[model samples]
Target: MALDRTKDSGNNSSQATGNWKPIGCEEKRAAVHVEMERVNKLPANSSYATHRLRVLNKVLHLISIQRTASQNEELELLFAGISL
Candidate 1:
């Protein structure tokens, strides 16, 4: 009997799910840097600046979480291959 392996192929999640590609830390950081520069150009006390700053802070927090999760996943994979 033959076995099926279509879904087992090493394609990325974007291909399996939809057209959108996953954003990595570099892209996210670049976006944050660009937004920060724009916000800095605005008046210090302006409401829009404050709002953008808040959103940027949240993005930074999420990036931190993503980095931690990726590290944890690597560690888990490493340990998973070890013998007891």
Candidate 2:
């Protein structure tokens, strides 16, 4: 199953080489943990908490789409110099 494969890949990090963590991964993860704690302390039924949850979701979405400068350069090298 797709879910099993996903879990396997996540659990088997040693199989992957190089810089597995994305740029700023630790910082972003720490920020998310802080935000989650803050969110958890908010009243469950409050509109402010709802708003914060939505904002957090958006922030996570943006972070997922973000690429590092080195990744961009690698992509350029892959495409820009190709003669085919």
Candidate 3:
């Protein structure tokens, strides 16, 4: 009633062992820890924390500008010089 193809096929190899942990588990945990530490180190009402927030705002603004620039025609001109 059942078919036994194992004897018909001469190969007897087994699959290799795979990773036990999910991918990027450690990296995600480290990133969360670092963010938590950064948040804990800065006092809510301190001048230093206010200055750091301003700097981070500037950095985010620049990153948004860079992203917009990358989508423009200048990036096409930049890539024009390179040959595949």
Q: For model 1, where is the 10-residue window of minimal lDDT?
A: 75-84
True lDDT of residue 71, candidate 2 = 56
Among residues 3 or more apart in sequence or in different chains, the pairs in candidate 2 whose N, CA or C atoms overlap within 3 Å are none
Residue 26 in model 1: shift from native, Å? 1.7
- Please report, in order, the local distance difference test score of every candidate based on alpha carbons: 0.62, 0.57, 0.44
Better of 1 and 3 by lDDT: 1
Q: How does residue 38 of candidate 2 score in lDDT?
A: 84
Please give the lDDT score for candidate 3: 0.44
Shift of residue 72 alpha carbon in model 3, Å = 15
Residues 1-84 of candidate 3 have per-residue lDDT tens digits of 765544443333221232244324344335434544575587888886676555444433433454465444443332232211
Once all C-alphas are superposed, what RMSD does model 1 give against the true structure? 12.3
Winning candidate number (lDDT): 1
- Model 2 Cα lDDT, one tens digit per residue, 4-27: 433445646544433354436456
Ranking by lDDT: 1, 2, 3
Residues 1-84 of candidate 1: C-alpha lDDT, one tens digit per residue: 754444545566446555675556677667777877878899999998897777676565655664577765653443233211
**CA deviation > 4 Å runs, candidate 2:** 1-25, 66-84
Error of 1 at 18 (Å): 5.5
Cα-based lDDT at residue 5, candidate 2: 38
lDDT of 1 at 75: 36
Model 3 TM-score is: 0.32
lDDT, model 3, position 26: 45
